[model samples]
Target: MKLVRYRPAAGEAAMPGLIDGAGRLRDLSGHIPDLAGEALGRAAVERLAALDVESLPPVPGQARLAPPVAGTRNFIAVGLNYRDHARETGMAVPAEPVLFSKAAGALAGPYDDVVIPEGATQVDWELELAVVIGERVHRADEAEAARAVAGYCICNDVSERHWQMGGTGQWLKGKSAPTFGPLGPWLVTPDEVGDVSALAMSLTLNGEVMQQSSTAEMIFPPVFLISYISRFMTLEPGDVVTTGTPAGVGMAHGRYLRPGDAMRLDIEGLGHQRQVVR
Candidate 1:
């Protein structure tokens, strides 16, 4: 099932919904509070799957989408997890997962405008497969970590290279800008996503292809990353871990986003995202 959070209109409450077979949105608000915390767990998803989707009230007209999962407290990410991406930047493949955090406030709906922060010079993009944690776990084994996963979604790991590499060299400075983390058209449960390791993903800037690769290129897959992270910090429900981008970010080519530039990102089975720089 494809789960989503959205507002039917501006200033309205955000509600959870499911995308039925015919591509219509059906309200799931009566069934759950929101797609966060315990609602993200396997048991909750299983219960929701048993619902008769066709009977739910249909949401009319267009709605503004929020990130598929809400109340994300730890917006973590992996860096240099893709071999090709590592090679592109002339860096050696990491011996272990390189982790970082993007402030939860950076999260934005997939189609929301990506505001180029004032004085920003090297704004760039990183298309990544984002994993939403379903249950809290610490020091988990790979199998346990796998079970803790809620599902997957797309994440555009928007960056400001200057803030990331310059200044004091703190990655969070570059990565935590408002609207920097654009995620989800919807979240596809693991069963529906099939093999997570082989999905094709790509990003396009201004109608031109910029980044293209498969999840197969990842050095540390999702489950391992989750497990690795849990050893140090508790993985809470509704937290997101973006698995890192592939080769072809703007900085590598001396290109950067300017006002009005458009970006499109896609990960097979997880749907796509569109953003215009503003």
Candidate 2:
């Protein structure tokens, strides 16, 4: 099931729904009140799928899309989980995942604009696959970790290099800019998404292909990440854990985003994201 959160009109409330085959939003407001709170689980989606599609009221015509996982508690990220990315950044491959947290305020719709912050010159794009956790788990085993996964979505891990690599050295300062985390076109449930580790991903800046690699190239896959990270922190439902990005970032080539630059990110099966640097 492909789920999304959208506001049908300017004043209307953001509602969750399934993206049907014809690409229309089938409203689930009548069925699920708080989507991210409870119905975001894999089981919930499967249950909704079992119901007659024609019964659910569809979101009327055009609605503005929001980040699929709304009111997300924890927006976490893994760094350099892709070997090529670590190589490009001149870092060693980690024996364990290098984890970081992004402010939930950074979350934005898939098509939202990414505003390059003031005094920020080295803004780069890291196209990544973000995992949405299904259940609250702490120090979970591999089997439990796999079962805890709700689904996946596309994420643009936008960074400001000057603050990240320069200054005080907290990557969080470089990340977490408003509108930096462009999340999804849809939150694809696990059953509908096959082989999470082998999915292809790419990022293009202004129609130019810059970053291109598959999850097959990931040094640490999703399952291990969920398990490893959980050992340190409790992952709650609706919290997002974004897996690392592949190589070919703008930082490797000294290419940074400026005003009016357009970036397009694509993750096979997960869908695509478009953002203009503002």
Candidate 3:
């Protein structure tokens, strides 16, 4: 099932909803308090799928979409996990997964404006598959990690090359500006999404394709990343773990974003996103 957090119209509050088999959205706002938590329990997907969508109110076609999940306490990220991206950045493929954190404030809706900071000259785009954790786990195993996953969504790990490389070399400062992490079109459950690792991912600057690669190229897939990360920190409900992007970022080609640049991103099965630099 594909789920969303949306506001029905201007100034209306956002709430959780399910995109049914026919593509219409049914509000699930009151029924499930914490979908991430519910999705982790035994027979969870089956139970959620069993909800009577027909009885729920239909969401307006023009509803403003929010990132599918909210209250993301830990916005974790993996770096250089794709071989081609690592090569383009001229960084060695890490022997183990590379981890980093982005401030939770960076999260934004799929179609929201991507603000270009003042005096910023090197903003960039990164297309990645972001995993939304469904349950809490401390030092989870592979099988446990797989079950703990709530779903997947499209994420643009927007970056600023200047701050990323300029600092003491830490990535968070450059990565966590508000609206940098634009996520969702919807959250697609694992059961509904087949072969998560082989999905195609692409990002286009305006109308030109800038980054295009498959998740198949990931050096460390979602399951492994989850397991590895759990060993170091606790993974909790509603937390987001964004896998690294592939090659063709603006920084690699010296093609940074401009005030009027438009970005379009798509991930197979998951969905697409549109953003414009402000």
Candidate 4:
């Protein structure tokens, strides 16, 4: 089922629902408050699925979409997990995942505008598959890690090179700009996406295709990534794990985003995201 969080009008409170075939949204929160149940969002799906469709309320056409995962506790990212991206960035392929965190304030709707900071010139887009954890686990094994996953979504790992590599080594400086992280049109459950490594992904900037690669190219898969990270920090529900972007970022070509550039990205059945650099 396509799960989403949307506001029927501007300034209206966001609500969760399941996206129907006619493009109407079936309100899940009406019956399942807080989107919590036996398995969090999944339980809502099971209960909602048993209801009569004709009895459910229809959502407005003008509703504004919000990030699928609301109140993300920790938005963590893996760097250079894609071999080609590592090569383009002039970094060695890591034997283990290189992890970093983005401030939660950076989160925005998938279709939101990305405001390029003043005096910033090296803005780039990274289309990545983000994993949403379902349950809390510490030092989880690979098998347990697989079970801990809740869903998947599309993420644009927007970056500013000057702040990233020039001033300090902390990637958070370059990554934490407001509206830098655009996440999701939907948060797809794991059953919808079995075998995460076979998915295809791409990024188009202003109608130009700049990056195209497959999850098959990932140096470290999601299961191993979750397991590795859990050894160092406890994984909690709603904590996001952004897998890495493929090659062909603007920085690699010495090009950067300018006002009016639009970005479109997708990862197979997970969902798609579009953002304009303002």
Candidate of highest lDDT: 1
State how far residue 227 of model 4 sits from its true place (Å): 1.3
lDDT of 2: 0.87
Better of 3 and 4 by lDDT: 3
Top candidate, metric TM-score? 1
Per residue, candidate 3 scores C-alpha lDDT tens digits across 109-174 of: 999999987767789899999999988878999999998888899999999888888858769978
Clash pairs for candidate 4: none
Model 4 C-alpha lDDT per residue in residues 1-278, reported as the tens digit of each score: 66788887889877877777675777777665543223344454566667776577887587777887665778899999998898888999998899999887888888989999887878888899998887777899999898778788898989998989886566999998999889888878787778888798889988889999999889999889999999999877777889999999888898889999998998898768989888
Q: Local error of candidate 4 at 143, Å? A: 1.9
TM-score of each: 0.99, 0.96, 0.95, 0.93
Worst 10 residues of 2 by lDDT: 34-43
The collision pairs in model 1 are: none
Clashes of each: 0, 0, 0, 0
Off by over 4 Å in 2: none
* Candidate 3, lDDT over the whole model: 0.88
Question: Quick one: ranking by TM-score, best first?
Answer: 1, 2, 3, 4
Assess the local accuracy of residue 94 in candidate 1 as a C-alpha lDDT between 0 and 100: 94
Question: Per-model C-alpha lDDT, please?
Answer: 0.95, 0.87, 0.88, 0.83
Where does candidate 1 have its weakest 10-residue lDDT segment?
Answer: 48-57
